[model samples]
Target: MIPARTTARTTRTRRGAVVAALLALGLGLSACASDTDTGETETGDESAAASEDETEVSIGIPSGWDEGIAVSHLWTAILEDEGYTVDSQTADVGVIYTGLAGGDFDVTFDVWLPYTHASYLEEYGEEVTDLGHWYDDAKLTIAVNEDSPAQSLEDLAGMADEYGNKLVGIEAGAGLTQITQDEVIPTYGLEGMDYSISSTPAMLAELKGATDAGENVAVTLWRPHWAYDEFPIRDLEDPEGALGDAEEIHVWGTSDFEERYPTLTKLIGAFELDDEQLFSLENMMFNSDEYADEQAAVDAWLEENPTFVDDLKEAAGV
Candidate 1:
């Protein structure tokens, strides 16, 4: 077997190359800060933020995507606190990307790259500025309960009957659902089973029911999800490369956004979040019943992560 360290090293190298190419196209880091010797950019962003422009900002959040919604709200609170009017709306990824390309939406924080959203970016990349990616290790997977009969998609394809002869899915318009319908099912010859296109909530309900009853069920899922912590489920290995590789979650803005909101652009460019921080924020915003209002959820999250805004401000030099 290949050494695990070598495999990890190879994966990271590939990820770095993809990130570099994306930066070359337009990560817009030059608009924010200078590159350091370590290839990481110093994020103070004083190069542009002399005065914060007080303008109305429109942000798009992808429907059924918790991460997008969380970040959209998080940024909304931050930007509004910085004295800007912010409008946040929810829609599908396709609609958001199309609107962004046409200069209708000002910013969106959940564009997945080099894999899940390659088509959208290919069509709209030139029309938009990639503020930068905040999170890496985002991936799509077909998950099953811990006690399921199959350990991988290859195993499931042949034993469809064991998983109720079906595969549960999320929102019909979601990227994960589309990719599973178009690429995954075909690649694995899973056309024999019933593939149900439903909403994320519906899929979660099904998952909860199945797992609680000790039944077998497979559903489309993604990493950095709160469900993994709540449910006793695991991702099925994809040996045929049907599902794409790990993706970086990026923030996208209209091509002229930098000119329109220089300071905001710089601040957005300096954003970064690891899995733990993101998962915690998302859990607070989504899973917690105590904070129904998105802004309130953000406030509660800030209470827990007291230095979040302060650290980001310091990094952005605002």
Candidate 2:
């Protein structure tokens, strides 16, 4: 289970590519959404445009991050309608940022800042341009099903055996996973509990199963996530400040991105989605089976929000 996309649909020339992205296990080039939008997770390495047309844009996002996945495709839909060809890539935060610096990627919508993606920006900040901070309130969390005996990370040490001594996590490289392993576990005396790193989808499936059986389960997660809305879970209190504070997720690109994409940059800079709007998009794209395609899900989401696309466009003066 690949988690929730950031699945990189690589190299299409439609000016509005919504190509099928291959999951983390493969590199054959495809479409997926990444979080770098509260955006943080993803897989694959394909980036850049397939055409010489300046209107063609290449987007990248971190693999397995829902916020990234949702917004990447949302932008794909809008750009497509506006007659701009879009090529989107999904990969790890490291890979995406690397590519962005190398000019392999044009822009990425999910760049969590001041915490989750701090290492990335520290290394690549100068090479990339900040389009804008689209959404604030993105956060990383250690969540348990609402009925669990443990209400906080500290409480887990005593009941580790009751929950099978395991804390399920998303992709190994995910920002959430890293924070859990490096910060949360040690700070909370949770080394006794087994921390497992699997794909986001795997963690989600486990979440579903645990919820279905009414079992106690813990997993890595974040705000602006579809899980909080769809799952019967609550974040464990990070009383010791292991998980860090709320963050602003930004839109990022190559250093020259703003120069080349002024109008689009303005539109992107104007972009922002609150919890309800973002959750709706993620749930539609990742949680629902209603639409068989990424673009279709985005279209449905836009229909409900009604004025989101136009509002961003208008705000950007595009």
TM-score of each prediction: 0.82, 0.83
Q: What is candidate 1's lDDT per residue for 1-318, written digit by digit as tens?
A: 211110010001112333343344433323454466665436543533534353778887787787887888777766655446676667777778887888777999998888888888788889999999998899999999988789889898899999999899988667788789889998888999999998887899999999999999999999878889889999999998788889899999999888888878768878988888888888887678887566777767765665666677568766
Off by over 4 Å in 2: 1-53
Instruction: Estimate the overall C-alpha local distance difference test score of candidate 1.
Output: 0.77
> lDDT tens string, model 2, 228-310?
87889999888889999999998888899866766676678788888778878888898889997767788778667656665
Residue 310 alpha-carbon offset, candidate 1, angstroms: 1.8
Q: Which candidate is the best by TM-score?
A: 2
